[model samples]
Target: MAVVNEGALKKMLKQYKYKDLTVREITNVISQYKDLKPVMDAYVFNDGSSRDLMSLTGTVPVSYRGGLENCL
Candidate 1:
């Protein structure tokens, strides 16, 4: 799982709040920081169907204590 620096992320978001940021632009910001870089992984369903969470939808799940709590 990728660890994010909340303060840094919030500051960056505030800096770009006035602009219409694209996914790529946001991704670039995240990628620029090591802790904020997203980890690519696949999500598999009970039926054996799987989808790459990163590529399928530029969002990644946030896990805490071995449990998923949210998506980012």
Candidate 2:
């Protein structure tokens, strides 16, 4: 099982509250701090499949704990 970096996620969320980051930005951001797949699924938006990170937002990450970039 993958682990959730709550500290990193929390920091990303705080950043989101201040500004909007693009999917690429978010992708790169999380890549620097934690695992990509888990963070995208748990925090960003997703249909449970792989897709360009730029297209998902607002809808997929609806009930997420973190708010960084768009979901994968």
TM-score versus the correct structure, for each prediction: 0.28, 0.24
1-72 per-residue lDDT for model 2 (tens digits)? 335455554454553543234434555544554434423334344666543222223323333567545353
lDDT for model 2: 0.42
The residue ranges of model 1 lying beyond 4 angstroms of the native Cα positions read 1-34, 55-72
Estimate every model's Cα lDDT from 0 to 1.
0.48, 0.42
Candidate 1 lDDT by residue in tens digits, 1-72: 334454544444443443234344445655543334533366799999986443223444567899965454
What is the Cα-based TM-score of model 2?
Answer: 0.24
Candidate 1 similarity to native, TM-score: 0.28
